[model samples]
Target: MAKLYVIGIGPGRRENMTLRAINALIKSEVIVGYTPYIEYLEELVEGKEIISTGMKGEIERCKLAIESVREGKNTSIVSTGDAGLYGMAGPILELAKDIEVEIVPGVTAAFSAAGELGSPIMHDFCSISLSDLLTPWSLIEKRIENAAAADFVITIYNPRSKGRKKHIEKAVEIMLKYKSPSTPVGIVKNSGRDGQEQIITTLGNIDYKKIDMLCVLIIGNSMTYIENDHMITPRGYDL
Candidate 1:
């Protein structure tokens, strides 16, 4: 049967990609993804029929991938981090009709950043994207407030960009209403990939200017703390 595999490439590195993701790419005849993400596939997609689009071309990419599957070709659409999280998986499934579709989950940025930041997300958490392109700013604000109020360790994605400079700042302001200003916050950029950078600080002291779309912010819960330069959110364990 013709199949469309929505694969998460995981931080654009072969080592970070799961074996199943690699096998899915190997089995696929057509590779579709954002241009940068396609580059991350590197040699793995060599000699395959490739389809790439630039930013704001997500719907087009999904249609192209679905078309390839309809033509009886095994196609794979790639997403950096987990395909299911703010990636191609949702669009592919929404637009695909009468086609076999499989979601190959890969490590998300939250997990990758957590690893680099020393387990800041050891407890329950929620991911919130600060971008208001598809979602309303009001809705995003409500979610942020709720997440903070619930005391879920929060992992933030797409925290800042050129046009949306104040989004993260506003989010932090909302979080401060519920969380302590001294709550540990870990920022990781290019997590699990080359040129990775990280910062361990508190909610009151974050250098918002240093954060960008490529970075992920892990805001620790009440029980979270920074110990020996590593962010740790204990899981209620007692020595």
Candidate 2:
């Protein structure tokens, strides 16, 4: 039987890795992931044959992992966040094509980002991937506008890259159309890792020029507040 392991690496912290995920990693003979995801497991993945590639190479990487599994060697594919939530799970499963694939979930970056900002996502919120590589920007804009109109807190992923800039600012502009300029915005870059940065700003004060691809941006709803230097998005219990 060909067994494929779809694992979640959980942000960038080694300590954040779960016991089940660790066991899965240890048992795998070969590991496939993005370059950064592979580097994160360097110490944990001593001796396994590793295949690392760049961003947007997920389809190619998944193929390598699936082929390795078919050859009777335990093979695993790694993702940065939760396996299923905008992570590697969907791609891996699509490649599985009726094979028995094991899914080991991990914490998503948004949760880690939210924790760094002190539970800003504790209430009802929606997660959005700002990258328009696989999806259309028009669709992305509609969701942002709808999320803003519904007053739902939004967590954005893959905000800005070297080639793709200004998209995040466009998202902010959409939010600003429906949300107040003073609404709290939480920006977390490389959360749960060294060189981590956390900033709390507002729709009117955010500097989009300073943001990078790795940064995760959170735009609050109209009810969102900045309290004692923390960004908050209430669950609407307040009168």
Q: Tell me each candidate's TM-score.
A: 0.98, 0.94
lDDT of 2 by residue, 67-109 (tens): 8987888888899878899878898877778667999999888
For residues 4-57, could you state the per-residue lDDT of candidate 1 as single tens digits?
999998987789999999999999999998898988888999999999999989
RMSD of each: 0.8, 1.6
lDDT for 73 (candidate 1): 99
In angstroms, the error of model 1 at 136 is 1.0
| Best model per TM-score | 1
How many steric clashes does model 2 contain?
0
In model 1, what lDDT does residue 126 have? 93
lDDT: worst 10-residue window of model 2: 230-239
The reply for model 2, stretches above 4 Å from the true place, is 236-239
Per-residue lDDT of 41 in model 2: 86
Off by over 4 Å in 1: none
